[model samples]
Target: MVAAALNGGGGQAGEALLTLALPKGRLAEEAAAALRAGGLDVPGEEGEQELVRLLPGSAFGRDLRLLWVRPADVPAYVREGAADAGVTGKDALAEEPQGVLERLDLGFGRCRMVVAVRRAEAERWPARLAGEAGGLSVATKYPRLARRYFLERHGLRPRVLELRGSVEVAATVGMAAAIVDLVQTGATLRANGLVAVEEVLPVSARWIVNPVSLRWKRPLLGELERRLAALAAGEVAAR
Candidate 1:
């Protein structure tokens, strides 16, 4: 299954190959496993191997091209048509520059995009933070969504400080009043005395394609969209 998604298919669909911009971490490996489980042949061991490949098309007319890319870069690759489509987090789509489009969801890489503030400052949550004269200062890896969520939800404009990493350090140095980041287990948040008071969005790895290429690459993207959608639906029931 994982082997097949990485390779190409044959038949009338042969001329048009659907390439996927796959994430470079666990989601890539997990997605490959899921595709393989759904009868897509799995290939490539992602262990020490970082390079992505396109294997030979099989007789059943199932062939796919998978591209290896950083998870954050997946959207731009798909949106630009550098690859036919991609599997990336919803968070990636949210943070992408403007004009983002994706046709379907792969339903993997479950996580949340949340707004975090210092644990001791729980009383100063969304509403009160907005009342301040200068507004609450925020530090986030995702300045785009944070800004959007804050303004839309709180009716306030915050001074957002975009930080590369160590968002907790930003709070300690008073660079920002709080932070917004991806929270999976809340373990890191607990360690830093930061807790999520607001949630921006729920995120998952999804199937994304270029808006223009949707028609030109219908055979590849269309088939994948159907199969993956079904798999995602079934996965929901199972859960």
Candidate 2:
């Protein structure tokens, strides 16, 4: 499956273009800014309501193209060879890891994947989970990670309810007893009357490349990595 996904490359003509799959939100804006700061003139502001944006080769001295996609789909696009590379969060990478090469840590979009529950039920969480007679219930956008954390890591069985959005409201509306979600700040959790119990993993945006693309498009991809690394270093120094 991994091989099949990585082998679907563009034709010879298309292979000459360095296509990048970028998430369509704040992450995209951050990525575009980073590239521009690194001397690659990435045109098109984010949130432009476009699916694809073609950038002129004169700006970066290479044929560059950008494909806007959902954050979670970035890796898939790269893996499937629809794009040579992509930027996505670590949490999304954890959910899907086949046929993708995580090349660099972009250092933005930082957050944590955590286990949280309503504050009122916080005290009962451990004991209730300890009993294990009836399995616990969890709401999350990442069902795979949530299941592994509960069943494998913690040795507890849980009914994982997959939700697209509004995971915090699950506990309030009686959908689930707890939620496994991403938290950049405690504001959202606190606002939802939920308290984080444990952190599943730390998350940040990552630069990922298709292994096949890495092998074939090494020159352009390598240059991109070099520029982005310098940009990241400058960002850290500025902070």
Candidate 3:
């Protein structure tokens, strides 16, 4: 599905161009800045909310297409070939059920996908369970990854239910035993009386290309990839 968007050479002939999927939110600005820092200048355009709209390749050296999308929709944009490549949070990748290829960590949107329960009920988690037969129920937007992680690592089956915007409400509604969610500051969890039980995974903004596009659009995407990687590496040094 992702093949169609990356087709055709640029004006220079044989200049394979690529379409990248980007999330529209606070993450968008950071993603663009990273691209610009990498030397891929993102040209400003007309009629757009800071939230949506992708930047088309500039007449300048920049030739990649950007499609700004909602947070959850990024995967569909990539998997369906709507965009040849995309930039999104690790949380999205883990949630989507597909054998998609994951490349490069942009490093700016660093966070963690973790398991949590009400602070008062945190002690309910047994250090050791009696057997693998007993199942655990978990809540998350990433039902797929949450279930797989528990099954593969802990040898227990997880009953995972997806929760969206009002995640804290899941706990109060008794819809889940615990939640697997992204934690940036840990304040949200605490405000909801939840404590981190464990981290299912660590995440950041990732540069992903359609497996086929990664090869076909290598020359094009590489232009941006090279720049973002350099900037990400320096974050630690500057601190």
Candidate 4:
């Protein structure tokens, strides 16, 4: 089910344009800024409930179609060929990497995935984990990554509970012994009486391309890469 509203393209000619899946919300502003910084003109009329839009070649130096989707859905769109490329979180890529080639780190939306627990149980985390036997349960939005982390890093077999939101409250309410979640600041965790116990993965937005697109549209994709790479380098250097 592709839940996207397309905007900006005209006629059969638009089908030949390079398409990109751009995440909506906070990352939308950042993605546009990055594209503009790369010297591409981003122009489009905002329409109510539009998820996909096009920028005419006359404005952007190339006929470009943009698919606006929820951040988490970006990878799926690219993988499924709904888009030739996309901007999404590294964590999302990790969750679903098949059929996608990670092209560049766009250098925005930085955060970390971590294992957190109620503050009162911070010191006992290690011992508790060790003593839990085969019944250890962990709550997270990323069950795949969380289960892998515990098994590979700690050698613990855990029952991973996947939740759509509010993973922080898992431990307090006894839904699980701990939670693996993304954190930009510890403010929310602390407010919920939780503290990070282990670092899982460092995350940031990434530019990804469909493998088939890479082969079929090499020149255009390369040019896009070159422009975006320059901006990424500048960001790295300024940091």
TM-score of each: 0.83, 0.89, 0.81, 0.88
Candidate that beats the other on TM-score, 2 or 4, i.e. the better one: 2
- RMSD (Å) of each candidate, 1 decimal: 4.8, 4.8, 5.0, 4.0
lDDT against the true structure, per candidate, is 0.71, 0.81, 0.68, 0.79
Deviation from native of the Cα of residue 68 in model 4, angstroms: 1.0
Worst 10 residues of 1 by lDDT: 6-15
- Model 4 CA lDDT for position 229: 93
The local lDDT score (0 to 100) that residue 231 gets in candidate 2 is: 74
Worst 10 contiguous positions by lDDT, candidate 3: 5-14
Tens digits of per-residue lDDT for model 1 on 1-239? 55644443321223345566778876877777666665556564453164556554631364555668888898877766667667788888888845446666667778787888777777767655857567688898888888888888877678888987778778756667878888788888888878888888998887777776677767655766777788888777776
Can you write out model 2's per-residue Cα lDDT over 1-239, one digit (the tens) per residue?
Answer: 32332343553216557778888876878877777776676764643475666665723587666778999999888988888888999989988888899988888888899999989878886776876446688999999888888877778768999999989999877678889999988999999899998899998889999888888888778888998887777666665
Highest TM-score model number: 2
Candidate 4 accuracy as TM-score: 0.88
After superposition, the stretches of candidate 2 with alpha carbons farther than 4 Å from their true spots are 1-13, 44-47, 236-239
* lDDT of residue 8 for candidate 2: 35
Q: What is the Cα-based lDDT of residue 160 in candidate 1?
A: 89
The alpha-carbon root-mean-square deviation between model 1 and the true structure, to one decimal in Å, is 4.8
| Cα lDDT over the full model 2 | 0.81
Candidate 3 residue lDDT tens string, 74-106: 877777665667778888887783745777777
Model 3: lDDT of residue 33: 72
Give me the displacement of residue 3 in model 1, in angstroms. Answer: 19
Alpha-carbon deviation at 199 in model 2, angstroms = 0.4
Ranking by lDDT: 2, 4, 1, 3
In candidate 4, the residue pairs with backbone N, CA or C atoms under 3 Å apart (3 or more residues apart, or in different chains) clash, namely 5-52, 7-52
